[model samples]
Target chain A: MNELVEFISNNLQLLYILILAIFIGVELIKNVPSVLHTPLMSGANALSGVVIVGALLVMLQAKPDDFLSLGLGFVAVILGILNVVGGFVVTDRMLQMFKKKK
Target chain B: MNITLSIIYLITTIAFVIGLKMLGHPQTAKKGNLISGVGMGLAIVATIFLHDFEVPSINYILIGIALLIGSVIGYFIAMKVAMTKMPELVSLFNGFGGGSALLIGLIEFGNFSEDATQTSTIIAAIIIGSITFTGSLIAWAKLNGSMKDIRLPKYNLINNLIILALIAFGAYIVMYDSTNLMLIYLLLFASLVYGVLFVIPIGGADMPVVISLLNSLTGIAAAITGILFGNMVMMVGGILVGSAGLILTFIMCNAMNRSLSNVIFGAFGGGDVAIAAVGKTGGTIKKTTASDSAIMLNYASKVVIVPGYGLAVAQAQHVIHELEELLTKKGVDVSYAIHPVAGRMPGHMNVLLAESNVAYDKLIEMDNINPQFPNTDVVLVVGANDVVNPAAHNDPSSPIYGMPILDVENAKHIIVNKRSMNAGYAGIENELFFNQKTSMLFGDAKSALTELVNELKNM
Candidate 1:
């Protein structure tokens, strides 16, 4: 319980940031025209791939002989990269199709 | 935790916000996507270079290899996928993101101990991420037509029980034994099973809601993982995505005039309702020919095309674009009446039409085009059914009752193109088909539109 309280106090700033970012996010996404829903979704989907950083940090901290730890981090990094790359590329492809009237 | 990396993350966060803001307009949306991509790129580069990790060198090699393999596969898949498969691809990507978060949680749990907050966040990440991952896989399978809808009897009750059990089981782990690998594995297994159960009952047409919901789940999972590490960029980015997805899910539900709970629990489009509608005839389906439809379209001063899932199935977007061009050249004011839930996904029809080079201005939203239906000359419903069904508005007994739909019946003439007299995704008889103003032009959308275009050109 003491450790939990200590962690909370230490990370209070991050918690505030998380809450504020959510409000701003909802406000920003509220007005996106329906025509762009798919692209917008795909774009945000890519952003979730930020987990790759955590994967990298974990991989770098794992012991040299700890194959299990290393393997988990490695696969996580791959999946994260796939999400980041595929999401942005697919969103860009979809957005490219929305051309103005000639 | 370093000062320089923190500044980079702050910059990346701002870029994401600005990019999302720019996405509200069509002309700037592509550039907005590019800006976000660049921000992601900067974050990746900064993480690789600036992060202080005191591990062996082989790990770096493995990371490099993984990055290369993932990027190559991702790029090819994105480049090669047809526009019609966008939803499935997005679902697949969402699953990948969730899978990564789940793995992160597992790895972190192994590395950290004796910290209640960290343990709780790790468990939350694992549960949410696993559910998002497996749920998205089911959604992808359903979208691609590889999986059939399976609704066990009393599924809502069953789903509720499973959720309760999971909560109890997770609470047990958190309170009593957070270190038990066996219990954690069991929790993961249960979460995955719940994920499959969550999506198996949902019909394919309701995929937009499911996909959006899962997208948000993945974001929330990522956010929890960020909380585990106290990473600002991950925290902010994931929250943004989480909220964005929530907003879209609500928009999709509102567009259908349904609530989120109703969409998830109603099981409205599972094809069971069709049996109830069987042998209950509404009205006779009046058949029309391509030549007749062409003549009607040619003479009309204003025309609106209503498209749906079948239009994409028949791959008729190109021919439809040609038809629109032919009509426009004949001095007709042509536009599209796009219902919010028109295709398999949100803005699906717009993407299809845009791929065939249909001008964005010509694709009118439902609210803006609904009032114009009364003044419109002809409404050519190509391979669409449910959105134009009058039962939604008038038949209180209908499952889709109260759902806002295109007022195609208000037009002076209605020409519907379909392959058969079958019901749409909701499995209900469309009373609009039998309206005196409506005529069914039966055929595949592509061939029928091609013939209609030929007929109009000869006229």
Candidate 2:
């Protein structure tokens, strides 16, 4: 029973990766209208900042002795967050310039 | 601890989502940034408590010192650096990220033996990290003007051979489990050199594509590092970077009417040759007075303004905005046509225009504005060249042949505001100048635009 559980756990990561690869492939092949590309890309880049969450989780799960990993994870999360936030701010600032005056 | 971690992750993800959404429009980007910042802070706090290692005095001191130095330097650089240099700065930052990943992988490899599980991780990290590090460094050099934009002698064949040899050597070291780490280091060093050589040959005009490519490389490297460390977040983040970089690269390539392969292998350096090819018609160009041009502009029912790198160089955005205001007051419908690949970086013109408080609605992308040119009474080309060149449409043997261009010639009147009839950065003469409908208005962009503004005010 323990062996079966271990096998399943190990395979979970592979399955997740497969799903992600498929999503990326689909996105690439689909013809996104040119007008939407900039907005969509900006959106996607911002969403990519979601890695910070994973970083946070890893840090939280780190054992008491795993200081180096924890510290690195923290730094990653911080930087990732900054990227997401800064990117969004700049994007919005750009888009706002295009908005019709009230 | 698990709950805290989960919450932190959830927050980070939300921030990412919000940030991306905000990026789609300029209005909400600031809020998006704040959301992401909050998420980052949570992640940092969660990381601090993750491991219970007795804090080493020296390590803490080192971290503090590094942070202080980095922050101080970063602050000064950010404050002092011109906005024009932002793209190069971004490339440098990407290099640092790639370097970090490589350093982490090397450290990890030194501490561990190449087991079946570790083999894939180590190889992936080393290859991706090395590529990113070198590629970004080269990009930085190109942007900083440290390297010429043209290809070096026999660069194509030599670069390919070197890359192949390095890959083969790296594979051998990884497969054989040879305790000699020097071989792996050597491979990495070669790759770094190759990256610089590869990017150096690419011209300034291709910097946007280079930036996107390096960004993608950084992502791939980060992901590989994550895999080696069995870090789920790193893996996801890396993949994101790779995908985003690729998408941006594609967009930039499309804008240039060039393929990825062409951008990578094409020897675009012989700009001087292209310039010489322009028929030396000794006939001097007829120059228009600012007052005359302004009178035409003031009376026009509709006008389309096309901007380019020269506008950025002159810092004439404010004057242009004022001109737009004056034109609008005269009941002339005004709009701007923006080429995707204009300026040194992606969305560079937009940033400059926004800084000058130009209305966003007035700014239109190439496709949207291209169709509207026929009905425009006046087409004003401001510091723009290649994008407005008619050779793209008419000339078959032209280097920029088959590339899409703005149909500025279709307008009843075309006013080209440039310093002189010097060929653009691409070293190609704009056939638009020869068009019977076009008139040359020569002077510095800012001064010329300012004079036009003054004339319009008097009119």
Candidate 3:
């Protein structure tokens, strides 16, 4: 816990970015019209798939003898990849429907 | 090198926000999705080559194989699914997101033994992540029509016990020295059980709300993952999703006229009550033919079309679009009144209607269009039942009572197109169909609309 606090104090700039990011996310799109709510929600679903990065990082840092990490990392990597691939692709398909015809 | 990579990461973050902002507007939503996709791709590529100074020691071949396998599975499944099935597919993807986070948290829980805050954070992620994973899967199954709410004896009691146990276990793990692996594993499996039990009692009527809540939890889990890894992009991306999903869930709950707690614990329509309620029939409804409906539409000065899940089921989007166009050309004021939860998915009906090339401006929301229904000469309800049911207002015993519904009942002339007088998906008799102004037009929405088009053409 002390280490974390120390790290936070050291990386005050990144911490500010973190706090600012939340507001930018919350306030800017608060009034998303109902017509776009589902797509907006689904698009956000795709965004949460950003865990793929964290998952891959875990895999990279794991020791070779750490069978648990290897197995868990493998599972994490597969699921993360699936999430990004499926989420963005499906979101694209849904949004494509919003096109107005001439 | 670090500075260059950080710049790339910053660009990726900006791109995600821009994408979400653009996603709010109908005209630019598709473009927004594409923009975000590009941003995600950029982030992935940069991370692969840039982040760690030392080359990654992880087996590159395994990750490659896994990526290949996952991409193929995800790609083909998504492409193969029809728009009507999109919600199920979405739930599955949401489940995957949550499951992955939970898996990572579980692995990390034992590793971060010395740090109290970090350990607690990992445990929180595991609990939320597990709930999201299983809850999403249940939502998917129910949406897919493959699962139903399980009614075990003393179901609520058992449910409470499991929840208490899970919470107690989570707290214990955080306090325990070194966070024993055995306890962590127990926490995971028990949490999974709790997740299933948590969602199993909610009826299909609340599926949309359930899916939205689970989606947000997944977002929250991702945010927690970001904290654990100290990844700025992941944390921001998660906060965006988490915030957006919560907002959407709130909107949907308002639209459905139910509170989030009610959706979670009030034990909505399911099993016995739904069956018994549906078995109760409404008084005889007046029937009308396609020709009469066509004449009504042709002569009416204003028209409102209400589309629901059945509209997608019939694959009648094109026909509905054609009808709207024909009415427009004839100078009739045609608009759509969309209930917030109209279709299976959140915006499923809107997307279906849009796919048919319906004008974006013409699709109206329930709140905006409800008052307009009174002035409507004809309100055509196509494959929608629950949203238009007047029992939401008049019948206290109704499952969907006090729920906000469209004022289709207030319209001058109401025509409902359904294959039968069958109870709707909620298993509640839609009193809207039995309203004095309602006239039943029995047939597939597609065939009925097709017939109406043919009749209008001949006239």
Candidate with best TM-score: 1
The stretch of ten residues in a row with the least summed lDDT in candidate 3 chain B is B53-62
Candidate 3 regions exceeding 4 Å error are A1-19, B53-58, B271-281
Deviation (Å) of B341 in candidate 3 = 1.3
lDDT of 2: 0.66
Root-mean-square deviation of every model: 1.7, 4.9, 2.8
Highest DockQ: give the candidate number: 1
lDDT, residue B393, model 1: 85
lDDT of 3 at A49: 85
lDDT of 2 by residue, B318-415 (tens): 99999999999989999998887667765777767876778777889888888898899999899988888778887776767777888888899999
lDDT of 3 by residue, B80-189 (tens): 99888888888899999998899889788767657766887798888989998998898889888898777677778898898888888777776765556888888888
Off by over 4 Å in 1: A1-10
Q: Distance from true position, residue B225, model 3, in Å?
A: 1.6
Question: Which residue pairs come into collision in candidate 1?
Answer: none
What is candidate 1's lDDT per residue for B1-459, written digit by digit as tens? 678888998888888888888776789988988888888888887887787667578988888998998999999999999888999999999999999999988888777846666778888998999999999999999999899899999999998999899888877777775698888889889999999999999877788899999999898998888878888778888899899889989999998998999889988785667677655557677899999898999999999999998899899999999999988888999999899889888899998889999988889999999999999999999988889988888877788889999999999999999999888887888888888888999999989989998999899
Error of 2 at B60 (Å): 3.4
TM-score to true structure, per model:
0.97, 0.84, 0.92
**Candidate 1 residue-wise lDDT at B116:** 65
